[model samples]
Each structure stands twice: as structure tokens, then as C-alpha cells.
Target: MMTNEINKTTGLIHNEGNFVGSAMLFPFNGKLFAITAGHNLYGKKFTDVPNLDNLTVSDHTKITHPIRCILGDSAFAKSHDIVLLELDCKTEISNFLPIRFCTIPRNPKHSLMFRGKYKNTEDPVTHRAITYTSTTTQSEHKFLCQIEKSLLMNHNYSSGSDWLGGWSGSALFIDNHKELICAGVMIEIPNKGNDGQLLFVNTLPLKDLGFESDIINAENLDFDKALNAASLAAIIDSFDEKTIREWEENNKNSEQLKFLNRKLNEIYPPDNIVKNKNKIIKQLLAGKAYLTTELSKNEQIFKQYNSAYKVYNLDSKEFYVNTKAEALTQLSGIKSSYEEYLIGNLGDDLPTADIKLLAIYGVSEWIADCSLDFLKYE
Candidate 1:
């Protein structure tokens, strides 16, 4: 439903702690801009914006280029978690992905496209590499919605790639008569059992956020060369082990062969899932304890901020509360409570051992909230 050319507009946005989220290039006011979830640009300390200066955009081939500029002084924080950044210079619309100008609930059957991370077992073909994927929405909420498929690498049910915590900010698009249009930006992974539902900031609201200028012009976009049937078959055949092995045997001195083998090993590295499970579960449980304590301390600090000023939602202006108590309730009630999050994510209903990975995700969400004062003020 999507083309490989989507790869050109997608890249990773690195957080303060080596944490990587996804991002995409957009054309606005006749200039190219980088867009992502507002949370990805926030620093761990939350006092000031983390430096993304000279940020480079990487492609599927692992090529990188610098972003021209970050539009405003800070990310446009709102209830939707969407942020629009200005590029340092103008670029051809062909260089970035195109956004769809459609009504909400575009269609129940629309295919969403994005470039996200995957593990060897989850997506053995492109582990550690940000690759293209097409998935559809299962349900939509008032502000955000869930992706029907999980993007984890080696889960219990399917051997397909699902998203990890690092996949935040990845752009979501739908195919409309072969035309790819941007829909939303990923913001969270829903912690409901083995279901790795992704939360995305719907981009249709960009118009209300001052991005309404010239968004629907198709002349600003470009399409990549389509792969013919024979070329597609040949490419798929190269993935065959027997073919690759024979090719290697024939080209004993081929550097390309050696490079290909090394890359394959990285994608499907030998590691026991059983051992990895035990280690991860133990770490998550211990981490939960530590974070619980930190959450209390963080709560007290937030109280100080709340008492000084009324808190505001960064993405959506309609949801500000009167008191810190009400605000905290709104924050925790975001989608679900911590207990629900733990129960839905921790139990054995899921197939993979990494389902507990959401525990750490819960911790980060709490930590980020503790610094809500740093986001935006009324």
C-alpha cells in the first residue's frame, strides 16, 4: 500500500539518553520542516529544550543530512503531543513525504505508513535498521488512536516487527489512490496485554496550529520509481539463504558478499529469548520499585509547580484544569491508570517476554510528567 520512497522523509529523533524516536520532513509555507512528538524534544531534566542543533536525518541506506533549523524557541506543546519544526533551508517537496488532507476517520480501512525500529527476530530482515511498514488503525479515541498491529520484533504470536519505546514520533500516513498522505505522529505504545498499540498525534489539526498554508498542493511532491515484477522477484530471491550461500561460494573475494553477511548477522543475531526474558522480567520488576519511589518525590516537586501556577496542556488548549489535583488525575487517566497498565501489560496473555517492556515505558511517562512545568506555561 506504501512505497519505498517513504523512506526518504522518515528518520530518527534522538532523546537525551540515547533514546531514539521517529520523525519526518514536511513542507510548510513553501519551506521544509521537521516534525515529531513534542515529548521527544523535551530534555530529561525538563528545564530547557534539549539541543537538537545540527540534527541529521538518516535514510534506509544509512545516509545522514543536517536539519536546517528548529522553527520556534520551543516545541509547540499541546494535548495532541504534535510539534512542527522549521527546516534551516528550503528543500524540494520531492525530498519529503506528503501529508493527506482528509477528513477525520479518513476511512476505517486506511493503511498507515511509517519507518520504525525492529529486532532481528521481530523483523529479521531489517533488524536495527529503520524500515518501512504499513498497518491500519483498529480504533480511534477523542484525541489519539491505536494502531491495530504490534511492531515488536520476536513476540509470541507473530515473528513480525513491532514498535519499541524508541518508536515515538514516527509519522503515520494513508494510501489514497496510490498517493501517500500524512495522518499522524506516533506518541506512545498502549500497554494493553500483548497488544502493542501505538498512540499517534493526528496531524489533521496542523491547520488549526498555523500550518494551513499550501498543504494540499500535489505539485510539491514526487514519487519514486516503482519496482517492476521481475525486479521485485529478483530482490525477494536474494533473501534466500541457498542463493546467498551459493553466491558467496562463487565470489570468495567479494567485499560486497562479506558486507552482506555481516549485515545479516546483525539482523538475526544468535541470542536465547528464554535467557533474555528472565533478565528483562527481573530488571523490570526492580525498576518498578525504584520508579515508584521516584514518582512520589517527583509528585512533591510537581506540587510545588502546580501551587505556583495553573498547568496547561501543551498540544490541546481545551483541556487545562483548575488545580494540580485535577491535572494529575487527567495525566494518570491518560488512556488508563498505572495499575491497569501493569496488569494489562504484565500478565502472561502475550506471547513475547518483552511484553513487560511497557513497565519501563510507564516509568518514563511518569518521569516526563514530573517535568511538565518545563513544557509550556499559560
Candidate 2:
């Protein structure tokens, strides 16, 4: 492995619309793939992933090729904020990107001990914060963070670390020198008032999210040299909640509706089984439409992004809450929390809704809404 001075850890988020995270490189299906946080690409447009040939690093064109976005309440947010993508790269077999990632499929293979220079402490909580030198900020202050925690704070929470922005999705390696190892995914910088630690999510806990299977690692002689090499195959378009649901609903309804119609035939028997042809046909059609609408509605709602709604017995005016909240209410005294139950066990299912393309205004307006991500499980 080539060795050089630890270069400045600054990444240029090129995915359209300023996805402020680091890119990951991994091997997938005989080609190199790049990974990013899923929520970063939710509500985007594109058919195929982009390549450097189409757009390069820090190019102003970044506003065009958006990353695929994941929802706040989805399972992706719970286990980990990770997404694997493919990149178009042509490199020699012997050469690998300086920072390469391993799939969670084999994440255990690379586990090792971490010694936090900033945390000062040795042991780290699995998803807790650690200390890392800030490249963007001029302050010598250490940052507080927790992304799949791998280190403890060297000093107590005197001040918080400032990741600035665009540091999420960054790959962290423990002991970059002798005991080098790929560790976690960076999500955000700690607030100035945070307990002086760098935040990151460990890739280990998120292995089950299928991100590792899609990782596209770009090997490099130097960290900076690996920019284009490390970036994932640009998502020429993203399948956001708005798009995924529509695509899934249309495709699923077409297929399931056919199946349901056949089932209806079993129940109604094609009218030939009875004598009143037009009357029976008309009655059958009406019933078929009603059932189809109900079931199809269920399937459609089930396929949308991280939202859960109760089949409100219109009689009950109170909005339903989830069991997670109910469980919390037992202690927190928010007794009404138990009413809304999550739509799915994993909260990965999509909600049925007519989705539309998100304009710049839509995103700006939802900044606060995005922060208050409604956890279906919660």
C-alpha cells in the first residue's frame, strides 16, 4: 500500500443538490460501486447513475444529477443511513483506491481495536461519538460525533466539534497508519454545544440494510486522487418516495389486479354459471371495483416511503399513535402515544400517496419537517 502524509479530509459532494456526505467505494457484481447515505437521494430524478464522463468532482453541474433519497421514518434511517451505488471507473487491477470499503456481508472480517487521539479515552460506544481532527474549521477544537461509535472522548465535553457540512457519508478508518481499517460512515458534525466529539455511524450495525452488497470501493494511491475513483456511479436519477411509490403501485396493481380479478372470477364465476348475464355482470363489476380499490389502496399505501397511517375508524376523532410511543408513554406520561400503530414491522414499506416532483421550494420549506422525521416504529 502506498503511504503518504495524512491529507486534508475534505470531500466535494458532487451528487446533484449538495448531498453533504462522503462517498464510499466497494466491489459489486464484478464492477466498482459507490455508496452514500440513502436519505441524501430521496426525492430525486434520474434513470441511470451518472459517471465522471458526464460530470466530474465539484463541478457546478452537481445541481443536476441528484442522489437517490431515503425517507426519514424508513428502516434505512433506523439501522443506518447508508446507500450503496455503482460508479463507472477504469483502473488497473493492481491499483486500488486509497480508501476502499468492505461490504457488511464481510464487515466482521475487518474489525479491530480503535485508539482515539482526540477522545483521549480508548473504548468507544458502538454508535457513540468520537474525536477527529476537523479539516474545514480553523479551530484547533476537537469535534463530538457518533456514527457507529468506535472511540471515546479523550477529554470531557468542553466544547463540540464542528464538521461544518458535507462531511456525512464520509468513510472513517481507525489507525490509518499501522493498524489501518475501514470503520464507519460519517453522518453529521456535532453542534458547537455538543459534547466535544465527532459523530459517525458504524457500518457494522448497518450491514443488514443491504448497503454492503452494493458498495463500490475506489482504490487510490492518495486520498485526494481517489475523488472520482471513490464516487459512486452517479445516480443519473433517484427513486424517491414520490417516484418509487408510483412505479411500485402501477407495476404491482397491474399484476396483482390481474390476480385479484382471477380470484374474483372464482367468487363470481364469469356470469356463465348463472342465468342473468347483464345483471350479474353489472353487479360483479361493481363489487370487483370496490374490492380492487380497497386492496389496491392497501398495496399502494404499503409501498410508499416512511409514513404510517391508521385506518381511522372515522368515528374516532383522536389521531392514532404507534406502540413505540405507547411504550415510551408508560414512563414519559404521554399516555396517548399508544394509539398509532406502525404500518409495517420494519417501517420500510411505502405509504400510498400521490407523489410529485420536489421543487427547490419544497425542500427549503421542509427543512424543519425533515428534522422532525416521524418514526413509524416510534
Candidate 3:
């Protein structure tokens, strides 16, 4: 069965602002805006949380839309996870580097596979067996649909997928019927294992948020907009698959390691010294020295993580990254943490040192050891 390829909930965010999560993007007043969790922004502006510098993931793909964030008026939009925003300074919206919704509307009352894009690619990639989740726990379930594709992108944040500290304001969206629509903002997630089911904010009105649990909309926004304006399909379908394939190939060769590179742009390492790679691999399987020192370098990778503490600031998600890097660089010395899916236990009343020790590790859903006495490092 071909699983419906759920388009990703994504938007290109630029400019400077605060009190928002990078996972949120919504259209407002004809100008596109980056929507986010209000708490992420309402903190001190430009520090420790989602700000312009931190929110912009790849400046090479900057969004030219106006940026603004005001306390959301749910009465007007009827969406609580939403906030009104305007872009900064002088910028006009362009479809060239257009935006996407992180969340997409769905008819649970109707039968359809949920799907979305995890990262941008030259050709639209499709995945089957889609899984969607939401963040709220009050008798209603909300979810950011996670597609189980093998792409090395945001496929597994709760399962060894390294979702960075500054990815909140970004929207999780789906590309539906050639037009892209948002489904939810990437709110915080529980990292223990369920991948922060509570952090997902589905655009669809979940029963917990007090909306129709079994309603489906037939009106297609993209089709109507195109007929009214006579514009091309939303950027997702507008792309030429061949051209994008070539572009993706060139990028992978330039960007990825030779062994892990995908088929689209896969190539061998240039050095002839790497010839007879299979023979060398066999020798290593038996016993070899090439890996002796090279593999040894990773022994104390956490030691270098001290840079985060040295450069601590109330502002800058970099600080958070540094702290996490510090704790994770030494996964060998670490034992499994049984915190039941809260990433780093941030919302807990655990002691400071225990919190520090746990914050630095990655959360893979593989069941952990249960019988061994627990170990907590300060």
C-alpha cells in the first residue's frame, strides 16, 4: 500500500522577533507571518528562546515576507496556537522562496492517510504508513503528523532525530492536492519516547481544544485561490521534478559523506587510497589499526562541550545547543534515562545536577534496561 506522502509543515522564517516557537507559521491579513507558541516569545526578547537570529534556520533560504507576532486573539481566528505577526522593515512576499504551513487540515471523519514533508527536496518525496500526533492532553488529541520516511532529516526527533533547540516557530504542514496547507506548529514535545505527543499542535480542531471532533471540510483553498487569481499551483507542484532531481543530486554530492549519500547523487570518495574498499572493510572486520586512533577520538567528545558553559547567555539558543551537546557527546558513559518521554526533563522538579546530567542525552524509543540499579550523575 502506498502510504500517502504527507507534505511537511514548513515555512521559511526571517527577520528578528521573540516570544515564539520556530515551528509555527500562519497566514494573516494577507501578509504571511511566522506563528509560534506565545510563551517562547513573551520571554526577554532576543535571548535564550526563539528570536530572529535563532529562528532563521538557513539564511540562504530567507523568507522575504513581513514578520510580526502579537498575542493571538483566538476569538477572531478561533485558533489558540496562532498569533498575529507582521514581517520587519521593508520586505515583500515572494513565491520563489515561498512558505508552507506546518500543519494541515484533515477529515478524521473521512478515511485518508496523514502525511507531510520533513525537509525540502528537488522532487517531492513520498512516504507510506503515516503517523500523526498532537500536543494537548485534555481529553482531546492533537498531533504533528510524522511520516516514517528514511530521509536523514526531521524524520525522527523523538527517535534519534536531532530536532535542535531553536526549531519551535517552524510550522508542520502538509502539501494537499498540489497546494500546501499548514497542519500545526511544532510545539515542545516529550522526548522520553512518545516523541512529545503533547507538544504537537494540530491545526485541525481537536476535541481537547474544543472543536468538532468529526468534521471534514470539502472546500479546497488552493484550487479556489488559483481560479480566482489564475496563478500557478502552489510552489510544491510547480517544481519541475527533473530539474529538482538534478539540483538535489548536486547538493548531496557536495553536502553528504560519500558512504551515506543517497542514490540520487551518490558517489565514491575520490582518493584511490579508498580503492578496494570492501577488502579494507574485511581487514577491519578481522583486526585493523586504521580505526584505532580515529575511533578513539570520540572517547571524550563531551569534554569539548564545555564551550557551552563558557559562553552561557540568557539569550541565544546557541547556549541551549551548547548545553545539550555537552551532555550528549558522551553517550558511551551514559545509562538509559527512564523519564517517560519528557525531553531533558525541563518541566520537572528534578534537582539541578540531575537535570544537567539527563539533558545531554538523546532519546531513542528502544526500550531501556529495567532491572539494573539506576545511576544519576551530577
Candidate 4:
């Protein structure tokens, strides 16, 4: 997305008339979240209020809403340098960027941009032609980017504090030729002069924050290309029994490994079974299966399901569902089970982190049969 488009979803965080920092609307699962730098809420500069109840967010429309809850806190921010917030009002997802988590390491070859409000400004300024330097050694979670020199000089800041003071919690996007994928959040400036590099906390950590299956993989953004890349016969013929045996031998004792292996076998069965299941897999991928009717009611859910199926097929080398009827049955059962689980565990007194986790992974049942371990980062 472009800077002007992103500005529609960007907001400013305020505490008692003081401009804390910049924030952007993040759509995950079925909820809208506001993400910003952690220091804005928990840094030494702001000590009076440690929680979100005292905070409010104002977007470009100038409409303000009280924060409903703090899903992630300062402790997480200290390590991750990002804080996740929940707003009390409703917002259209179309106005915001799609939630695609960058899973690979970024380098100078990539085009980048930063969009956020500068000190109490209503409109966000776009900083273009950013250069990716290197990942910071202090933490694997953080990376460094040099701001375009001309843009930096035009701002004319005397010191690092003057340059980066109001820009905390701003968003960093990687332009992938087709669309801009949100890759990081601005956290700090490590140097003292006008040449200081902008330090950012990448979005990969959000998977560990319990958004693994919900966000789309940045690598798999071109769904149409992926769908047309190979035929079903080629996919089935490419399967290597030797490789499967080696993987099983390496992790023979792990129950999780066994489960994953069983699922893999189902995707690449005997020749007779492959002919039958191949039709099912193709129908599922093309959205012609029985579950498509139910999933189509919610566009977001359908998109997520489509992405999950594509990811599993391309990356994991497996397809889990056998038949259209079986998938529909499994989905219905999973929904019922999840509702019962929520009813039995969730209440008025659950911890904030626990509640956040539940909300984040609430849709895991949609892909319950697929292995999600590939979503995690090392």
C-alpha cells in the first residue's frame, strides 16, 4: 500500500493531551488491533500510567476512541519492542493494509518505505527510498535501516532525539512489486547525528505472539501464480518416499512428527487413492468444495482458508483433507468444540495475556489437521 492509503489506517496515541507516539490499525483474525512501539507506553518518559485504560487513539478522521484493553505489555515490549492494543470501536478492514507477515530476512535489494505522523501532526509523512543496512547484533528481533539522506537533511534535525522523538510506533513496509507488505515497526535510533539508522522490530515475532495461522505469509502473496505453478499429476509424481522416510527416521520418537507424517501420507497415498484424492485437493484449492459455501459468508475467513491451503500444499508438501464432506464435518465439529472450550475456560477474571492468546488462536480449529510448526521462526 502507498503512504496516502496507509495514512487512512494510521492513528496517534495520546495520554492527557500529550502526544505519546504514532500507531496503525492492524487487522488480524476477525478483530482490529492498534500496534505501536512499546517505549511509547512503557518508557521512562511516561511513568504515570502503566496500562492502557488511561490512553486513547485518534486517527486521521480526528475521531478518538478509548483503548478497550492491553493485549501485550511493557515486558514483551522490552524484548520485542512492539505493543499490541485493542480499540473500543469498529473500523473497516478495507481502509487498512492486509496482514501479511514477512517470514524471511530483508536485505538492501528490497524497496522500503516508512509512514507515520511527525510530532503532533494530523497527516502522516511518507519517507521513501529507505535502505536496509543489517540486522542489529543486540537482538535478532531488531534490524537497522538508513533513512534516505535527502529526506533526512530536509527535516534538518540537530540531534537524534529531535529526529526520532515523535516517530516511535511507526510502520515499515516492504514493496513487493505488486503490493506493500507491512514488515516492521519503528522502535529506535541507535546513532546520535542526522545519519542515525532507524531500528525496527520485525513482524515475524507476531507468530510467537499467537497469530501464527491468522496472518498470511509474505512469500506466498501471489495466490494465482501459485495455483497455476504446477498440475496435480506433477505434484503427486514429485513426492519422494525416500525423503519422507529420512524425515521420519530423524524425528521417529516425536508424537508431533508422527502426526505430521501421517498427514503427509494422506496427501500422497497409493496410485489408486491419489487419483481420487487429487480431485478433492484440486476442488478444495479452487474453492469448489463443500466447505466453500460456509467459508464464503465471511470474506476474511475464506481468504485465510485459501491461504492456509496454498501454504500447506506448497511449503509442507501435504494436503490434509480427504473429501469435501469430511472437511465440512470436521469444520463444524471444531467450531462446536472451540465454543465449548471457550465457555468452560473464559470468564470475567481471566488474565489479560491468557485472554489475548485465546482470541489470537481462536481460529486454529480451521486448520486443525494441518501442521502449523512451519509458521514459527528460529
Winning candidate number (TM-score): 4
Clashes of 2: 63
All candidates' lDDT scores?
0.44, 0.33, 0.32, 0.56
Residue 270 miss distance in model 1 (angstroms): 53
Number of the candidate with higher TM-score, 1 or 4: 4
lDDT of 4 by residue, 1-378 (tens): 143466665778888767878887766566667878877888844333565666888876777767887656556777787877778655565555654456433445344677777673556787866767888787887888877544443244355545446788888875423344577888876654356578888876666666553444443432222221221222334345553344336543255344434433433445544343333233223323113322233345446545544443353422245554454454345445544544444433233333232322333322323433222122
* TM per candidate: 0.43, 0.32, 0.35, 0.53
**Candidate 2 global CA lDDT score:** 0.33
Instruction: List residue ranges in candidate 4 displaced over 4 A.
Output: 1-4, 44-51, 90-94, 120-122, 153-159, 213-378
Across 1-378, the per-residue lDDT of candidate 3 in tens digits comes to 001223222333433632123433333345544445443444423223334444441122343444433434334233344343444423334322233332234322111132222323322233323335433453132454443333223444334223333344444433333344444554443452244232445444333333222322323332232221212122213334454344335644342223222211112233432333332222222221211211122233223222332232122221111232343332223323322322243323223332233232221101011111122244
Model 3: weakest 10-residue lDDT segment is 363-372
Task: lDDT for model 4, please.
Answer: 0.56
Evaluated at residue 18, the lDDT of candidate 3 is: 29
Give the C-alpha miss distance for residue 91 in model 2, angstroms.
5.8
lDDT top scorer: 4
Candidate 2 Cα RMSD after full superposition onto the native fold (Å)? 24.5
For model 1, residues 147-224, the per-residue Cα lDDT tens digits are 444335334645232335556677665432345566566666655314534556656555656666434422222111
